[model samples]
Target: MKSWGLLLVAALALSGSYAVDRNNFKTCDQSGFCKRLRGFKPEKSEYSLNLDTVLVHGNVLSAEVDTVDTTAQERKVLWHYAMRLSALVDGTFRVEIDEVDPLYPRYRTQLALDGEPKADGLKLLSNENGKLTLMNSQGHKVVIRATPLKIEFLNKAGDVAVVLNDNAQLVVEPLRVKKERIDDEDGNAVEVVSPLLCLYCFCDWILKCRQVFVFSALTAT
Candidate 1:
């Protein structure tokens, strides 16, 4: 615990000399990523997978994904996306969703799988009405609820173990670029990075897991 506290202190020091309200942990509003991404909650998801383009290779299944975004002014932009599903050896499925081509590069998770996932092979049960389901003999299941944009981890009895986007709060962030400005007498402005942007990239695990639940949780001994 002493070592952990020291590391935390060092991290705060590296971010520059700022007033430290050590007693207070800032609210969610203080987080730029939280403010920007959670500002608007959509009634429904606008993403759909193109089943016709689905490809299977070993234990990895992939396909083209599509989504439409509407601006506050009511203008809409069509975006391209991609999806990959992997069947793990331990009766688990790893689903990856990402954007294909965007105006700017977006953030992707940096967390690596703790161990190599064994490919147990998967059987596609259905792909109808924009919904997809995959299952293994152990009764473990992966279901993608496309309309409202949710994913479910199901147990053998068809009970939901974990759910992502259950609150209808799945907001896809578009690529954001740093703004260049000039504020000095010489007309030179230093680029300032929002703390929220830095935190979002640093907190990759929150986005990477996407409601992951393992049989055992990790803990430091």
Candidate 2:
């Protein structure tokens, strides 16, 4: 009877620990920006940038971006954004977009790239006709075209696994400072929510639940 009780307790504890609400996590569809970006099609891109200002610093390259909206309704919204295309020492390409001059810089978390990837030995093959082709020492080729700035990662067999900005839906809004009053008719200040705060709250709740389960298991043992 004692051995059966211990086995049952172990099984229940393991199951409880493994059980997580997968739906609680957000997906690309749930994120407004990602959803818009993913649905973008290249044929609808009205903006194009010239590759006249390419500066290569070690493995990093910074470039000037000139975007023109050819769309009839959006033609009046012509804007320029600074683009930094960096090839990390580990051979992964890091592309970042932000406003040319923002009132406040957007939050880019370092946690996104927490670990180093394996070195893939990327080598610049050519940069002609506004297209840059890079071949890894292992013979894998990556082609980056810079009119609407599309990137495609290809394997040796010419199969594409990842593509960035191929559809030209990248949008970076410049941050603006507003001096509007916080309180209006009701005289109550607006509520502001922080992503970090929400993440911490969720983590705390999970930890507390796990603690309770562990305590119950210990008492049963």
Candidate 3:
């Protein structure tokens, strides 16, 4: 009887850790950043690179991106964003972007790239016109386009991942400061807002993972 009870406890612990709730997540439309980036129209991309800051060292390239803000009433806002393109030793390409100088740096979870990619065998093909193309050791072609930048991982089979600043809605708002609290007639400061942001952030992540999985599966099949 003790052995059976132990077995049941172990099974419950393992299952609890692996449980995933699909409905608790948000979709692409729910995430402000993802929605803005994915909705980008290729035809409207007037992406330009700051050639002077482009640096290539070994397998990593870092540069400054000056993308046009088409959604602004001014027609465009000169936003300074940083772009890092690295070829992982494992042959998986990585592309990342964030605001160069915001009032407060946004939080990014590095745990997102949790696992190492299998040895897909990637090789650099060409770098020209603000674009870099690489052919994986497995013959898969990955393209990294700078200026209104985007990253597309593709193979002879089809595209695996395509991330673009499509609608040019990249908005990294500075975290605002709260004003001094004013006490109510009862001599206590009233609660202003609830802690909903934490919940929202987690939901966004799960949504992104689900969307990516669905998109990859569809493309692969």
Instruction: State in Å the error of residue 138, model 1.
Output: 3.3
Ranking by TM-score: 1, 2, 3
Local lDDT at 175 for model 3: 33
Residue 207 lDDT (model 3): 29
Candidate-wise lDDT, in order: 0.60, 0.53, 0.53
With candidate 3 superimposed using the best TM-score fit, by how many Å does residue 70's alpha carbon deviate from the native?
A: 4.3
Instruction: Name the top lDDT candidate.
Output: 1
Candidate with best TM-score = 1
Choose 2 or 3, whichever is better by TM-score.
Answer: 2
Question: Candidate 3 at residue 47, lDDT?
Answer: 50
Expressed as tens digits, the lDDT of each residue in 1-221 for candidate 2 is 99999999999999997897878889998875566557655445434545677665554456666556555565443566676554443335555655566555455444455675333344577889888877554444567787776767665566665666555654443344333336757988775433321111111122221111111101111
Off by over 4 Å in 3: 1-48, 70-76, 89-91, 108-124, 136-139, 156-221
**Cα distance off (Å), candidate 1, residue 33:** 1.8
Q: Clash totals for all models, in order?
A: 1, 0, 8
* Tens-digit lDDT track of model 1 for 99-159: 6755544444444656565676767789888777877546677777665456677877677
